[model samples]
Target chain A: MLVIRRDLVDAMVAHARRDHPDEACGQIAGPEGSDRPERIIEMENAERSPTFYRFDAAEQLKVYREMQANDEEAVVIYHSHTATEAYPSRTDIKFANEPQAHYVLVSTRDPIEHELRSYRIVDGVVTEEPVKIIES
Target chain B: MAVTVSIPTILRTHTGGEKSVSATGTTLAEIIDDLENNHGGLKARLVKEGALHRFVNVYVNDEDVRFAGGLTAPVKDGDNVTILPAVAGG
Candidate 1:
């Protein structure tokens, strides 16, 4: 299960809404082995396409180095699906390299309501996990 | 040239779980060959049809090898080679 803060969840939803029509992607980092996502690092979608999202190579390198220096790891790797359901696509499952991360998918297909779901994609397998939002 | 190769977590299985390992090569291709000699299965993961796989991002020091020369990017002594899987999806 993904136990995440309410504000972090809101931030991700806002980011998704802001990038509607194009997929938004980012990672939430926390102390190594802590699994508590505390920092939201919004990443530029290099592809900038409605159907695909990729992190800019240089930007990814920088963020990764910063995480290493700070002894943190990406606990939540998220993206939005503007017109699809909140689930991992074939491409998402195939490209998921972080076996330990919670892959969050937000859907903003409906302007009035949004759907958010989390999953674990490891070795080409996708397992949905319940998200427990913490108010504080 | 001796260089330090930082392996990503997904590829640690090929390196006996070693995060960083030393390899000798003047070009990225040569470094990959040397790494294959030691790690065995890494080349298959990083290379495909004689080129670096599209989903794998390789960096020599601070420069992305794709922008430099793909598999032929030059490396010198003490340089850092980082291999990160592309975080991407549809």
Candidate 2:
């Protein structure tokens, strides 16, 4: 049961569209607790794929540190598939470091085909989780 | 009995476009070597100089190999090994 914000999905879709032919990546910051497992604080758009992504390690570390400073945790990590579906690629699953974190994929291959899927990839198993979109 | 390994799109080119393949091994390392033997260059992408690729993640039945024993992770027949690349998207 993974809860995501509707706005976040929309943002991810927009980013995907904007970065067509490339990839869009971001992180989700939120509160951490059993009562409120995940909540989104903000979304970022990687400008370019620095060999792979526009955002570098420094930017990621900054965001992560900021989240920690705010006493928030990175609940979910997101990215877009400019020409692919919202399914976990073999590469995507292999890089599943945060087992507890939800991975949301937004596909912008077809503007009309807006698809957002969430999953929990622990170890190497990809498990589709129900995404509860919260509108704010 | 063989251990089943799932391939990702990025590395499929090395495996002759094979989405999944099966290899025999008692440990993950051996299985990886077997895969590379059948499919050249896959070993480099999966492992570098006998070490797991930094950007690539390996999972055994949905569990991250990082938390497991990594290359030494024990595997058995019918086990599913999924190879996923590290994707950074906003």
lDDT of each candidate versus the true structure: 0.97, 0.70
Task: Locate the minimum summed-lDDT window of 10 residues in model 1 chain B.
Answer: B65-74
> Candidate 1's residue-wise lDDT over A15-131, tens digit each?
999999999999999999999999999999999988999999999999999999999999999999999999999999999999999999999999979999999999999999999
lDDT of 1: 0.97
Which stretches of candidate 2 lie above 4 Å from their native place? A34-55, B1-90
* Candidate 2 per-residue C-alpha lDDT over A1-79 given as tens digits, one digit per residue, 9 for 90 to 100: 7776677677767776777667777767676543233444333444454223433433444554476577775577777
Candidate 1 per-residue lDDT over residues B1-90, each given as its tens digit: 899999999999999999999999999999999999999999999999999999999999999999999998999999999999999998
Enumerate the candidates' DockQ scores in order. 0.94, 0.07
The CAPRI quality class of candidate 2 comes to incorrect
TM-score of chain B of 2: 0.91
